[model samples]
Target: MSNSMKVSFCCKDCKRKMFDYYAGILNLYIKCNRCKRVLTLKKIDEKYVAERMINGKLFV
Candidate 1:
């Protein structure tokens, strides 16, 4: 199995909620699916990262 990082996207201009995608935190950037904006995933929370790296289910 491959390990991937978790990420969320937000718009730069509108600050609107955008996307959540498989992305590595070590990487400098990720693209927003909704707004098509480029953003740094580092701005997102660590809890999301913890959840992403875990087991088959992220929720109960």
Candidate 2:
């Protein structure tokens, strides 16, 4: 059997729940369906951090 975990995060601009991902994913780049903004997810220090991409730059 394989082990997996659920990872959920919210959009920085909209404050809405974006999606639920599996723990196996360490990094991801996605667009917020509600606000239509680009977002990136990264794992740091055993935690998940969400950042927004704006004007070709990343904002935390």
Q: What C-alpha lDDT do the candidate models reach, one value each? A: 0.49, 0.53
Q: Best-fitting candidate, measured by lDDT? A: 2
Residue-level lDDT of model 2, residues 1-60, one tens digit each, is 023434456676887777754434457688987889997657532233223333322333
Best by TM-score: 2
Candidate 1, residues 5-50, lDDT tens digits: the string is 4444446565565555463444457565655767664453455656
Error of 2 at 25 (Å): 5.1
TM-score of each: 0.29, 0.48
Residue 19 local lDDT, model 2 = 70
Q: Candidate 2: give the clashing pairs.
A: none
